[model samples]
Target: MAIRFESRTVDGVPLLLAFPDSNGAPWPTVFWFHGFGVDSEVHRPELRRIAEAGFLAVGVDAAGHGRRRLPDLQERIDQPHEQALRTMTRLAAQTAAEIPGLVRALADEGIADPDRVALVGVSMGGYLVYRALLEPVALRAAVSILGSPEWPEGDSPHQHLDAFCRTALLSITGERDENVPPDGARALHRRLDEQNPRSVHRYVEIPGAPHLMDGDQWAVVMDEMPRWLERYVLRPAHTTPSE
Candidate 1:
């Protein structure tokens, strides 16, 4: 079935909302970030499926992609732009400014759990989530698929991974990935474990998954997310049923 599409203004920026009918009322919500590319972040089928799991899914193109109607007020990102280390980092921070609006819109529609929202970002989007939230506390949980964190001035980006994994994050990397490398992911895994140590972090090296996962892997990763949202985001912090 075709996923229904909707749109609205967030801080004067056009953001896209998608959902598939699963007959569930007031689904949880996930703010997803698409990987870097010229591909339209618009109309992503997987993103829309969040609705089918009794949750709403919201996504936006950074100032440049898709609708192209947001304030690109941040410093101009470098070219191939997203490829430029500095540009990507700047764009990630700028995009974070818009998340509040995205959350408000979905909550106002009454299509999502106002308090049970989560974030799932890929590539640049993933990195942005880390840079923006500094932790996954804003939402229920965050799935960062191959997202790398950029270090502060005079620091290597890789050096910041530990401090960056400050949430219930599923840090995934391909065992043979060249872009981020297994060692980098491991370094991140160690830092997250050392910093938070409460098991909020899960590092998985796909037997050989690359920058992006294939169909089977994608399906598995997507399906597992709803459960995570239910446990961490939807369920209240501490409510045990009336005795």
Candidate 2:
């Protein structure tokens, strides 16, 4: 399984892309987001796994992170709780705004099939996934692990449930997560259920899991992500509206 890795700046966003070394233009793509204070390189293994599963997995470094990280990024993150939360939310919003541009760039380069694109993230990255989904960009599926839909600022995901009616979203959270509690996801799921959109949107909580999940819990996450994508994004009949 030969997977080629490339680091490039597309649409002004630093990205680490992994895909099959062999020819197959316009592959199904997953634009993954890394947690706060971390960079895309941390997800190298996950990116490789996604590539082996027949995808052009692109790891995105959210603003104030990775190559774009500001010199005082660590200090800002280490600030008091309320101050840090605000900073993180701002970065999430900025990063989410950049996604549409990156999607257009990827499609133009013929590296990602515009129709088979998905978003996956963890923690603050997961928050980014939800923020991006609120946009007009048409995504086939999304997986948010240990993420939240609430922004605590402008335009939270709860305010735009209708936008997600066409895209399938699977949210995974730890039952014992206090840093970013599962309540946000639980509330969103209940709302989505009420909307009753044809698209699949579900939330899963790992028993006895914490904000920073252990190896066994991660196993469940790794297993569930591929299964969800295979069923919703890789299936031939699965189609999403063009952006």
Candidate 3:
């Protein structure tokens, strides 16, 4: 089926909405978050592919970036590596805080089925997925590509393990990624595995890949991600019973 893309702002958040051209009502939705320094526009192809795979896809500009770029953004960008990471950490938290409301708003507007929502993020956006998992929203599944759940200074993002247990999760990282470290991603998978034995949890390490993936790696991600979501998140049989 063909897909259509629309750019809109909801509650001050700039978003790109992708849906099938067919008149489908209250479609299942996947929220896509982009990497640092880039906006939703950069992920249009991926978002559209998701929509093509029978989802109402949404891409949001994270706080302090893209359409919501902060006034001190240039200064912050010029900060030391540690400082920049800290700033992004805070911003990711804020963005995660806003997601539930955005989901509710989409539901209220009859744009998507709130109960059938998932999340996908890359790099900085991937870190936001970890933050969002700490929240109490009813996400069916989530995917983090080239990202880590470990915060700086040992601050954990696993406080809401039970909530996380209720959703299927896929973590993909480059085996050679020094920026985020693949070890942390593997540890996260192990922790989640130990905590929730029944939930669908997968951690994939792309061989010979770096912090930034090449076109082939992205092709693999684009192909496998939507299928994973369809099997574990969209299909009714895979739904997690409420705790």
> What's the TM-score of every candidate structure?
0.76, 0.95, 0.93
lDDT measured at residue 209 in model 3 versus the true structure, 0 to 100: 88
Q: Which ranking of candidates, highest lDDT first?
A: 2, 3, 1
Q: State each model's C-alpha RMSD to the native.
A: 4.8, 2.1, 2.1
Tell me the tens digit of each residue's lDDT in model 1 across 1-243: 556767765666666677757655466677877655432254377566765655667777765555673345233433444346565666666676677776776667777665666777777676766665553235556676666654333334455554443346666666766655566557777876676565466676677777666887766666666666556656663431110
> Could you give candidate 3's per-residue lDDT for residues 1-243 as a string of tens digits?
678889999977889999866566688889999887778999888988888877899999999888889988778867998888888888888898889889998999998888789999999898899889877688888999988787784445754566557678888999888788788779878877787787678888889889888999877788778877887666773457332
Clashes of each: 4, 0, 0
Off by over 4 Å in 1: 1-3, 20-26, 39-43, 69-83, 135-137, 151-166, 237-243
Candidate 2 global lDDT: 0.86
Error of 3 at 122 (Å): 0.3
* Count of backbone collisions within predicted model 1: 4
> Could you tell me which 10 consecutive residues in candidate 3 have the lowest summed lDDT?
234-243
* Best of the candidates, lDDT: 2
Question: Residue by residue across 1-243, what tens digits does model 2's lDDT show?
Answer: 999899999988999999866587788889999898999999999899888888899999899898899999999989997788789888988998887888889999988887788999999988888888887677888999998887677777778887766778999999999888999888989887876646578789999999998999999999999887776777563445322
TM-score of 2: 0.95
Tell me the lDDT of model 2 at 96: 85
Pitting candidate 2 against candidate 3, the one with the higher TM-score is 2
Better of 1 and 2 by lDDT: 2
